[model samples]
Target: MSTTEIKRIKSKVKTNSKYVSLITWIVMIYFVFSVVMLIRAAFLPEEAFTATPGLIFWQITIPINAGFSFNINIPMEVLPNYEPERFQAKAAFITYHSIYLLTYTSVLLYGIRQLTYILWSITDGHTPFTINNSVRLRNIAFAAIGNALLAGHIATICISIFVTQIFSMNILNISFSGLIIGSLLLVISQIFRYGAYLQEQYDTTL
Candidate 1:
């Protein structure tokens, strides 16, 4: 090919890559907006947690269990039906909310890391799933592990709440169960870290 032809080919490749990157950025922005809306709509309102059975699940349950009160904790002035057990339930609610807060932090961290990977991949003009572009994929996998750990936290909280509130399980048993789950999560996360390191080495060699 002539010199001019070669230059035009390279220019086209760069242009296409930039276009793809722009689309990626737009999609990521939409994703972030959706996530924020979901959290607000599903969990933040008063009616969500105190619904029919008074049991909110998943991400919504996290804040409820964690005890972040954005006007949701206001007590009814008139106790419609006074019961000692009802007061105990309210105390339990507070404890659950506190636990949820800790777990929610993990989720938010993982989510931010995931978005970082997406942005980096787009800006670098790197394909997310190619051997020649393995570094970006490795970053994505690390983010996945973060997400997995956060998911595990949610699961442990849910199981504990179910055992304690629904089935009246013992506290010691619940604590032990959570410990085991957390340990497994650490092990899984380490494995992902190792894989990411290996991919980084491979990329450097290339």
Candidate 2:
């Protein structure tokens, strides 16, 4: 691409990044609110614990000469029972979810902060292919992967806890999209690394 085209792309990136940074801040605030709500819900009286079970439903359709679709709903008791042992179980569950939420939000905020930094660098007229930019991109890739893995681990623990103490059902959920996005980010980070190396060589030659 020509220099003019590159400049135009950078300008767009900077604008979009500013908007995304704003959204990230908004989400962070919402997360804090959610944490407060979770704590409040956990401490409510036994009579106030009128919560129901959570259900996971999935449907898949195949289109071909012979097409078939099936829907399945799996229900798991997410709310704590008011019994002594069950109430203890509920407290443990709440603690686990709180930790997971905080950790997940922290990872996302770090990634967003790195993205904001990169955007600011572009807006400040710094070349996009700098060593710092490459490092930031790599951190983002790791954060994405970490978030996905952490989510899966937390889900598994949740399922295990509920199944053993509250219900007798199986639940498994993992975000394939998150894995794909993380992989793509990792690839892009490598590209950025190469670009930074080339930029360094160019600067040295000049």
How many clashes does the backbone of model 1 have? Answer: 6
lDDT of 2 by residue, 68-138 (tens): 32111222332323333343333444545565566667777888888888888888877778888888988
Candidate 1 lDDT for residue 70: 32
- Off by more than 4 A, model 1: 1-90, 126-206
Cα miss at 55, model 1 (Å)?
7.7
| Candidate 2 TM-score, true structure as reference | 0.70
Which pairs of residues have clashing backbones in candidate 1? 65-96, 65-97, 66-97, 66-98, 66-101, 67-97
Give the RMSD in angstroms, all C-alphas superposed, for model 1: 11.6
lDDT of 1: 0.42
Residue runs of model 2 more than 4 Å from their true location after superposition: 1-7, 57-93, 158-173
Q: 51, model 2: CA deviation in Å? A: 3.0
- The TM-score that candidate 1 achieves is 0.31
